[model samples]
Target chain A: MSVDKTTVAKIARLARINVPDERLEPLAAELNGILNWIAELDEVNTDNVEPLASVTGHALPMRDDVVTDGNRLDDVLSNVPEGASGFFVVPKVVE
Target chain B: MSDLLGLNAVAARDALDKKAISAVELATAYLGAAEATAGLNNYVALTADHALAMAAESDKRIASGEAGLLEGLPIGVKDLFCTKGVSSTACSNILKGFVPPYESTVTANLWAAGGVMLGKLNCDEFAMGSGNETSAYGPAINPWQGKDKVDLVPGGSSGGSASAVAARSALLATGTDTGGSIRQPAAFCGVVGLKPTYGRCSRWGIVAFASSLDQAGPFTRTVADNALMMTAMASHDAKDSTSTQTPLQDLIGAVGDGVKGMKIGVPKEYVMDGMDNEVVTLWEQGQAWLRDAGAELIDVSLPHTKYALPAYYIIAPAEASSNLARYDGVRYGMRVDAETLDGMYEATRAAGFGDEVQRRIMIGTYVLSAGYYDAYYLKAQKVRRLIKADFDAAFQTVDALLTPATPSAAFPVGRKIDDPVTNFLNDVFTVPANLAGLPGISVPGGVTSDGLPLGLQVLGRPFDEASLYRVAGVLEQAAGFTMTPARMAGGAA
Candidate 1:
């Protein structure tokens, strides 16, 4: 259950977070400590138990495929750090 | 004038109704009190102008005989709930300066009911920490102090709500419980916190952190105030697919209904080893009080209770990882610019999120990673089912289950900040109800030897918050726990 620095780095990258090299070691140790504590779950017998995904017990309520709310482009772009004419401005992803 | 801050929501509402005080006057008192106690760090943003505007509107409504249920009662909103046009960060750097264009359904409901907004109260960053220490603005100090005047942490991630309510800065405050966020802090601060059934309150605009477990409730000094707040906050919404369609029950009426002849279950599993001696003693006293009030106490066993914490840690983090992926630097909040989009995202998240939040995201990503999904995520989900089943079985025999709200009274601020596992364990007693989607409440039960507050928790069947209010009312009446924090009393002096 021990997590090494390499695994921590991998997880951090997967999560889209950057871990400075100096922090990676300490972060790995902390993660390992938590994961080790979580290992106690191995003792429980969960055979045939269905995974409980949603606690509400209701089917996800569906709405008709019609425009219900979101046509206000100004509201959508209001919080954008960088925006243009009805579009978010991100660093160019393609050349 | 300062005494107006001491009034509970029920009393305050009555005064506003009778014209004994104007909405503007009440709002001014609370706003002034909040400003006076700014050292507690209870609020992240004080919406004084908004409060005055809302109060003036409420005054007009009262004049026209159109007063709402909570007309003119000033309250604190947890920073996690989005306030339209007002800064609504989840007390994390990631959401710095993020003013949500849309309001959360719960807050919208409150405003519709004529509740005035005092401010956005501070919380643990993204509701991640048990102590408020993880908040980017710094921890909200518990109004209660320990020996030698050491400042204690108001248990969190709803620490600010609890502290403000306890300190009399706000008559009532909104709190969302994912794990023990509401109940734990309420217990620590000797206030009442109710975590309604999952989906009882819509999660439309509250910043998501473990969606299935997060539920918005209220913090107040009394069960009746909490009940009133709950009545206002709970509503079905089209936006939240998981929102329940059940009509809001008569929660306020249920408050005074004593627990007579009701079957209360004492879960044998909750009396764990190494628990605080005062907490154990207070729990026993609470059981005795319920018995005295004509409730039949039955001993029940929830064998899977011990696994709830570990299972919750896995499931919650996994959900958080997925939900937080929406916060990539492109659209909102702080963005660290770089040569590429991926680099920008990495830099922004690394700089924006705090240590605890980053840790959770890492754990979540690790658990849901391709090779480990079945072992960690799926296995935790199965344990979650077992936990729910245990509650279902217990509820079949008894109307509600009673347990200690938290392991101990408020501890020193820095006692367990560095230890994530220890801090995570603070939610051990409260997480099971969240995992099972049952309604739970924490009511002031007693005080520690040093005069700190402790609480007793009641967990009820799904959508059965009325029964919890009834049992909690009996406990509230019996405990008669009236010790206020030294800081709050002295401040009034």
Candidate 2:
């Protein structure tokens, strides 16, 4: 149940977070500590138990496809770090 | 009138309705109290102008004979809920300077009910930590100073709310409980906190932590006030998919309806090994009080109680990892630019998130990762079912279950900051209720020998918070626990 530097790196990548080389080992140790403790869940017998994804056992209410609320361009862009012409500016994906 | 800040929500509401006090007068008193207690770091932002404006409106309504349910009562809001045009950061650096243009459904409802906003209260960064130490603004100091003026933590991630309510800076404060965030802090700060059943309050506009388990609640000085705030805060909304269609019950009226002949369960498994003696005594006293109030006490078993924390840690982090993914630099909040989009995301997240938040995100990513999904996330979900089943079975015979709200009384700040696992264990008593989507309340039971407060929790059937109020009312009457922090009593000028 112990996590190593490689595993920590992979997790960081998957999470889209950056971990400097120096911090990876300590991070791995801390993750391993938590993961190891969590490993104790293996002791429980959950056979035939359906995974409870949500406590509200009913299906989510569906709504009409028509738009109910939106169209506030200024509000949408209020918190954007970089935006112009009602569009967010990000690193170019298609060079 | 200077003591107006000391009144509970119910009393303040009565005064406001009687014209004995104006909403503006109450709001001004609370604003002054909030400023005076700034040393506790309980409030991250104060909306004094907005509060006064709202109070002025409330005063006009009162003059016109149109006061709302909570008209003019000042309350503190946890930073997690978004207030329109107000800085709502969830106490995380990632959301620094982010002002939400929309208001959370809970806050909107509170405002509509005539509740005045004192300010945004501090909390654990993104509600990730139990001790409030992980807050970017710095931990909220519990107003209750232990021996030699040692500043204790106000138990979090609703730490600021608990501190403010306990300090009488705010008559009531909103809190969200994912895994005991509301109840534990209420216990620590010697206030009453109630986490209603999941979907009881709409979550729209609140920062997502662990979507399924996260629930908005209230912290107040009395069960009656808590119930009053709950009535104002809970409402069905179309915005939150999980919001229930169940009609809101008469929660305030349910209070003081003593729990006579009701079956109250004392779960055997809650008597954990090495539990604090004071917590144990308080729990026993709670049962005795219930029995004295004519409630039939029964011994019940929740076999999966021990598995709740592990499963909660896994599921919450997994969901949080997914929910928090939206915080990439391209959108709202802080941004650390880089040459590429991926680089930008990495740098921004690394810089924005605190260590505890990053750890949770990583844990979540690891558990929900492709290779580990079934082994970790799926298994934890199944464990969640068993935990819920445990409650389902117990509720078949009993109206509610009583247990200690936290393992021990409030400890000094930074005592458990270094150890994540040890800190996580503090939620051991509170997490089961969240996992089961049950309504739970923490009422001040009594104090330890050292004068720190302890709390007794009562978990009720889903959407059955009324029974909890009935039972808690009996306990509150019997215990008559009236201990307030020395700092709070003498600090405010």
Candidate 3:
């Protein structure tokens, strides 16, 4: 029910955030505090209780299978941190 | 000289309708007030030119006798709601300089109804924090100060919207409530805020946080103005599949309706162990006011209320992790280069997100992890159902529940900065409403002996926001809270 420094580091890595080594201990402690509090939910007997996957029970609206928006390459790429010729620039991936 | 910024949206609407003051003139006043109160750090961006342009358009419509419901009103948008062409960062660094290409469904509706944009207001980074301190742009300080004259924080996520409205900088402001974001700040700022039913407003174009819990609402100086704003804000957008198809009642007319013969519930469990005595007193006063207004009071129990916070912490973060994963230095926003793609994501997210956001993401990732999924995420969901059922059972007997909006009055800035758990307690009362996906409103209840504002919250049935408004209007009238903060725009005289 509690996390350690290694677990904190692992969680951070899994989350794709780079947490410094020294910060892991403190983060683990913080996470433990929250998790310890969250352990209270385990006391609730969820037997035969349905999980609430959605807040609203309305049926999902169906729409036509047509393009509502497109053809604006500039606008689509407008916010890219780096871009060239309408494609977002990223670090090299393949050799 | 005429103090145009001092007027509330309803008063301004009347003046504009009569042509006593032009839209351009009102927009100019708000633009100046927003600028004058920049020290509060309430706004991330002020759109002066856009305001004037839109105001002129509003004037033209008025000239043609075609003014809409909110014609000539200047409203502030929470940074979470995308305002096209204006820089819309949820007061976070990751999305720094990320100007949304399209308008959010809620704000677009506001604009279509003749509302002018005063600016983009500040909020917690990704709307993640309880106090505005987590905002990368810096916390929006509450305009209300205590006897000690020390600075106080505007409650988070929607702090900017609440503070600006209270300071008379914006007549109305849009706010998103995930975990008490709108209502908490509204309480701290002594303004009115409401989180409508989950699907009452469209989620499209809003920077996603907790998808299931996040609901966009309004911050206004009066309950009537809050009702008016909701009328413009709520709509069934085809773009947002979750947007409700149910037709909305007349929210504006609801403000005038009386709660006569209605049953108001005072949930006995909302009285927590360490809640401020003043807030407890305020709750009692709210009950008395409802009774005087012809509402028969019933004692109700939402036993699962105690478990709502822990469940909310688990579920909100889980959704936030999935939603925020899109910020991997890819499509838009801040990017940090690295030798490899994974390194780049690690660097970009680490550098881009603030402390609170990173913590939430990590917690969210942990809960959704392979070994922990059932124990945390799924268990939380089951608890969520119990929480909703508690409301359902209570609503069967009582029309709505009256509770304190926040646990305490606005505390000094950075008071609980190091203690995130303590900060989370601030939303304890308000979070239950979100978990249940019901409508809730925060009306100015009274003030602490030190003159800080407090808010009384009323929770109503699903899609029955009209009841909340009617209850809130009655509570507001009884509270007779007519004082503004001493540290408002242009400095309260």
Candidate 4:
């Protein structure tokens, strides 16, 4: 199940990371090494076993539905790359 | 008074209580020492004014006799933690100029406990790399040089934290362990590093690495200091749903309980052919030490032990890729404006993330992609369950499991193989604890022939950090690891 240049490139795009054409070959090889190692998980029989998404030993604590926090308009926008008028500025998406 | 630098957090706290050293004096000494050790590249920011002001407040609290547990104790904050108004980059170019507006729950807790901020320390970008090399600011050089005097790597991504604590730049340093980030660096730097149970500490403010595996802990010069710092760090918070409502244990109080009549397991699976000879020796020495401390050593096996690392790779990256999606150019960090929204995300992320981070993101995208989801992501999670089951079976018979912290000691910066899989092998022994959601600690046990420190690890049942620290105390005592790095801050012993 080794990934090739095409697979690497596709995933790179899907991952939103820009990888150049020449770099794709080397990345495929490196990714292959990691994937090949991870393929070892196939040796274990996980049949009928539930996937453990988290290791938290207890149930998620339920809380009453309430807006316990808010109103810090500036704080949310504090780290925006570019912002004005209390809104995040981004490249236009809607045609 | 100059010996204020020599005191560990516990002793320093005692001195402050006795009025032998004022909080201001201690902060001043640590701040000066932090400046002196700038060459180690441990600190990304030195909050001297913050420290002094906090120390001044601590002095007033002392005057009122309302001192907190870590009152006046200086600590180094990992750059991964969001310190309000201070930049928390996680040592990545993507977040190069980003200053978080809110304080992380862990750092906020430390400050609330009267722990003074020394500064934000360096770390692997988003806590991804095994060594500090992946950091954009450059690796934090290990304070300990080999016989040849070549600068070594303080293990990552908590390398800066380990280096600072070992160098005495800070009495204690906060480190987040997603995998072996905390323990590996602690082992390499000859200090105590502990990764508490998964939900033991709040993750509200620390930068997310692998959400499931990430646990906040401490790096300190002594086991007791680790206990003191851990007590201050863990808490239940509404901000982090994963934060535990389980009551916090008396960690510092449990440090000296000793391992008498305790059952410590020695897992044979940890022994491997390619492992360093000195690391093997140290594990054996640790077993002998625990036995000498009245512990009954029993042989145990977590049959799934060998598969832990491979499983970790899938799960960690899968989660990382998802978590890092938040770094799109629009919100924060280094932005490379592109013609379109998707184009902007691609360009900014590509330019912002390092080679290692990009690779992980790519792999994660591959594994979790539509068709490969079950074959990779789900399979890995099942394997994780088996790994936890193995630990459960072992813990049923033994109170805690002991193993080597890292496969080897610190290597010269760049001496380790750069390829991803080979480098991931460095964490062979430490990652299982993270996977199991259990408590694990690294105690500096011995030095390699090259004079680099190696550590022995103790993994305990979930929420049972007390047992883990108890065995660490025994190993720490038996090892008597007093050898200081060639270069240390504060001229500390």
| RMSD (CA, angstroms), candidate 2 | 1.2
How well is each residue in B1-493 modelled by candidate 2, as lDDT tens digits? Answer: 5578678888888888889999999998889888888999999999999999999999999989998888999989999999999999999999999999899999999999999998999999999877788899999988987677789999999999999999888888999999999999999999999999999999999999999999999999999999999999999999999999999888998998999889999999997766798899899999999999999999999999999999998999999999999999886999999989999999999999999999999999999888799889999999999999999999999999999999999989878455588889889999999999999999999999888999999999999999999988998999998778876833542
Off by over 4 Å in 2: B489-493
Q: What is the TM-score of chain B in candidate 3?
A: 0.99
lDDT at position B214, candidate 3: 91
Candidate 1 residue spans exceeding 4 A from truth: B416-418, B489-493
Against the reference, the lDDT scores of all candidates come to: 0.92, 0.92, 0.91, 0.91
Tell me the interface RMSD of model 3, in angstroms.
0.9
DockQ of 2: 0.88
Q: Which candidate wins on DockQ? A: 1
Error of 2 at B64 (Å): 1.1
Question: RMSDs, each prediction?
Answer: 1.2, 1.2, 1.1, 1.2
Clashing pairs for model 4 are B104-B205
Q: Could you give candidate 1's per-residue lDDT for residues B1-493 as a string of tens digits?
A: 4467667789888888888888999898889889888989999999999999999999999889899988999989999999999999999998999999889999999999999999999999999989899999899999988667899999999999999999888888999999989999999999999999999999999999999899999999999999999999999998989999988789999999999899999999997766899999999999999999999999999999999999999999999999999999888999999999989999999999998999999999999999899999999999999999999999899999999999888888877456678888789899999999999999999898888999999999999999999999999999998888876822643
Flag clash pairs in model 3.
Answer: none
TM-score of each: 0.98, 0.99, 0.99, 0.98
Off by over 4 Å in 4: B416-418
Please give, for residues B1-493, the per-residue lDDT of candidate 3 as tens digits.
3878777788888889888899999999888888888899999999999999999999999999999989999999999988889899888899999988889999999999999998999999999977788999988989999999888999988989999999989999999999899999999999999999999999999999999999999999998999888999999898888889889998889897878999999898997878899999989998999899999999999999999999999999999999999999988999999999999999999999998899999999999999999999999999999999999999999998999998899988877455577888999999988888988999999999899999999999999999999999999999999998986875667
Candidate 1: CAPRI quality band:
high
